[model samples]
Target: MRVHVVGTGLIGTSLGLALTRHGDEVTLEDAIPTHAALARDLGAGRLPTAGEEPDPELVVVAAPPDVVARCVLGALVRFPEAAVTDVASVKGTVLAAVRAAGGDTTRYCGSHPMAGRERSGAVAGRHDLFDGRAWVLTPTPDTRPEVTARVAEVARATGAAVREVPPDVHDRAVAAVSHVPQLAASLVAARLEDLDEDAVALAGQGLRDVTRIAASDPHLWTQILAGNARAVRAVLTGLADDLTAVVAALAALEAGDDAPGARGTIARTIAAGNAGQARIPGKHGGASTVYETVRVLVPDEPGQLGRLFADVGEIGANIEEFHLDHGLGQDFGVAEVDVVPAAAAALAEGLAGRGWRIHG
Candidate 1:
């Protein structure tokens, strides 16, 4: 497959690297000449030499959300015989823009690769970024079947699982799953801005996990949120209502009102969160499974984690999830290892017998 990737940023460069590794002939291009040269240097793909006119079988427009439609349209015009696809996270807006611009709808399909790191640029791109990730194809009624198939084939070649959904459906789904969560994380993280050092020092693994995506590029995310404004606003509106109720309940408690339902309101809110968290897909996109957690005290030193992992492997216990947290002013950390309920007891016993301190 001859694939031409436009905009050699993280997704574009990563796709180029993956496709090139899969033996596809990928060509690199970007608005910034240095970015394209950097991607080519990183073994993503090659750049066109002088007097060379390269025609691609597929043109992947991996531009930012704001310019994705324009890039897709340009690709369709530049390579009339090739199928064109854009990897913008927001699909509905791009599709509408292309349609309004009189682009060839049959040869253009919008796609979203549900994979990214908090980092950006070609330097942060990895060939395996899309491994086992979902790549959604949002095709309109006029999209040629062959065009969709061609894009799916290339996506699968990068080890992504392909799924099809309507553009509006894709936007709504991501608003809840991706966009809203980013906003929530950012909102929560914003509260820590004015905190004193003492208050911030008490941060734990929970805070780290919550604020991880808060490190995302604000410029990029702003474009994404604006592109899918309607869907994001709908989800945020529901979230605002829930937050208002929680705040009112807290205020009732603070005023010593002894409100009969205040506690119940808080309890229900937390319970609802638990239910939603539990419904999240488990490892490898499987149905959620309950696992018992085994907490161990790990010394804060080199090679301790590797030894623990080796011991766990020796015990023949499959780890379903894992988390590590360091205590404030302590020389050790807690390693929370989650395994099947049946394996928890034996794994704990094995680790304890090997001079490991097992925390309850």
Candidate 2:
């Protein structure tokens, strides 16, 4: 396939790299001169140029939310022979914008690769960015079968799982999964930023985990969340309701009133979270995920982490990952181990029986 990708940032550049490796001819285009030059240097481009006759099998628009539709619509108009797709996170608005601009609907499809990094730009592009991730294609009734197949072929070149969904459905799902989570992480980190030096000194892995996505570029998130405000608001409404319940439960626990009621409320909330979390698909959609965090107190010394790993090894279950929560105030930090849902319960039980203080 001879492919042309516009907006040579992380997504476009990554796709260029993947397509090139799969023996497809790739040409990268970007509004920024440096980005185009960088893509060429990084081998994700044949070089971006304007006013050239666009001849390609597929054209992927990997632009920012604000300009994605305009760019893709322009590409489709100029290259009627090629199938066009976009990797914009927000879909409904982008697709509408293209329609409003009189783009070629039969040859264009809205797509989004459910993968990214805190970083952006052609320089930050990686060849394996979309490997084993889900890439959704939102095609309209007017879309031709050949165009749809070509878009799927491009997705497969990146080693992504191709799924078809309506644009509206994709927008709502991303609002819940991606956009809202970014805001949540940012809020967590922002609250910590307001803390005093001494208070922040007690920061641990749990806080870090919640706030890691906060390191993402604020400008990009601003565009994303604002572009899909209604969907994002719907997701936040649900989150606000859940938070209200959790707060009430904590308040009851603190006041030491209605012990049974508080326990029941907290248990139900935790169970709901666990159940919802288990539905998150694993790598390549191979399995459903259940991450049970088993907290173990580890001494703050050399080889202590290694010993914990060995101890976890003795439990005879696979450890998917481990998190270290540390503090200067305590001599020991908590290690949260992640295992499969089936293995999590037994791993926790077996480790606890061996004198390990494990938490769920």
Candidate 3:
């Protein structure tokens, strides 16, 4: 397929690279000439000028939400034969905008991939960005079914799972699952900004984990939040109600209101959270696979980690995922191995019996 990608940022560059790897000729374009040229130099795609004729089977508009509609509509008019898609987080508004602009909505589909980092720009693109992520496509009455399927085809090529959902449904679901989490992360991190060493010294992985997304680009998120204000506002309203209950619960606990009763409720809530967290899909297009993490101290020498994985293969079971965090000035770092819960107990025993340094 000859593909033309607009707005060669993280998502666009990643897609272009993936398509190029698959033997498709991809041309990238950006409002800024430098970015398009840079992406081409980085093996993303060749740059195409705005006024040039586009010979594309697919045109992916990867701009911000506010500009996505215009980009998609423009592509539809310029390359009338091409099927178009936009990687905009908000859907209903963009689709409506295309109609209001008197553009051919039939040739374009709205898509949102449920994956990204706290990063942007072409340099931040990774070929594996969309791997294992959910990509939602929204099509209206005027949209051609084949064009919408073309978007799904590209999504599948990048190892993404495709699901077709209504525009409003996508916005609402993303507000609850994605946008709300980003805001909550920022809110938690914001509370720590003014704290002194005494308070800061108490930081741990829990705080770090909750605040990780706070590192995301605020300017870009500002645009995103503003564009999807209605959906985000609804999510925020629900969160406010939950926060009120939580505040009351904290007060009740402080007032010594039946610790036994309160503890039971808290315990149940924690358990529910555990259950919900476990439902999150595992890495790289896998199922809702759960893993019990067992950290092992491995030497900083070559083949040490390889030998560990070779041992895992010897056990005739699969490893779900693993994380490595190197300790400063140490000969060893911790490799937290994630395996299916059913195999966790036996795997731990096998590695322990083999005299490998295993940690809980």
Candidate 4:
């Protein structure tokens, strides 16, 4: 398939790279000529020449949310015979804008790949960005069934799982799962900005994990949040209510440990958070299974982590998750390996047999 990707940003360049890796011819374009040329130099795809035929089989608009509708509309009009899609995060807004502009709806489908890093631009693009991630398709009544399926092929080519959903439903779903999380992460990280250097020096993995997404591009996020304001606001309102309750409960409990119902309120709030966290799907999109940790002390040396991973694989025990805890000024750190409860003992025994120190 000949794919013309408009806007050689992270998503656009990643898709082009993925498609090209899968033996598809991809053409790259961007509003900024340098960006498109850089993406081409990075082997994402070739830049289309002047007066060249723009007969792309697929046209992917990867512009920011504010400009996505315009780009998609332009793509649809420029390549009337091609199937058009946008990789914008907000679907309902873009789709509505395109409809309002009187663009050809028959060939346009709104898609969002639920995959990205906190980084942006062509330099941050990876061929495996969409691998094992969900790519949602929002096809309207005017969208042809065959055109929708053709777009699904583009998603599948990047190793993404395809799911068809309504535009409104997609917007609401992402508001809860994506937009709210980014906002919450940013809010939490914002507190550290003015903290004392000594206070911030004691930060651990919990802070790092929670604030990772806070590093995302503010300009891009501003556009996304504004485009889907209604849905994002709804999510924020619910979160604010919960936060207020927690704050009140904590204040009451601090006044008196046995404050009537205050302790229960705090307990219930934490319990609810635990329940929600547990409901998150795990590897391969299956229910998250309870895993036991096998802590091992590893030297802070080159290939130490690699040696540990190789040893775990040798035991045939699949690691579900792993975390490395580095204490300040410590030469040796603890590696907590999480595996199925059944395999935990075997992994520990196997590592111990190989003379590796098992802390737990």
Strongest candidate by TM-score:
1
Off-target runs (Cα >4 Å) in candidate 1 are none
Model 2 agreement with the true structure over 115-150: per-residue lDDT tens digits? 998778887888899998889999988889899899
Number of the top candidate by lDDT?
1
Expressed as tens digits, the lDDT of each residue in 1-360 for candidate 3 is 888999999999999888888777899889998998889988997776667776999999998777998888889888989999899888988888888989887897889988887778899988889988888999877789999888888889888899998899988988878888999999999999899988887786578779988988888889788878999999899778756666667778999967556665566667867987877766764568667887888899999998888887887667777778666567888888888788988888888777788875
* Reference-based TM-score, model 4: 0.93
Instruction: Report model 3's TM-score to 2 decimal places.
Output: 0.84
Q: Estimate each model's TM-score.
A: 0.96, 0.81, 0.84, 0.93
- Report lDDT (CA) for all predictions: 0.95, 0.85, 0.85, 0.92
| Residue pair clashes in candidate 1 | none
Residues forming the 10-long window of minimal summed lDDT in candidate 2: 282-291
RMSD of each: 1.4, 4.5, 3.3, 1.9
Q: Show the colliding residue pairs in model 2.
A: none
lDDT of 1 by residue, 27-68 (tens): 989999999999999999999998786799899999888888
Q: What stretches of model 2 exceed 4 Å from their correct place? A: 48-52, 241-275, 282-317, 327-336, 340-360
lDDT comparison, 1 vs 2, better candidate? 1
* lDDT-best of 2 and 4: 4
List the candidate 3 regions with Cα displacement exceeding 4 Å: 48-52, 255-275, 283-290, 295-307, 324-335
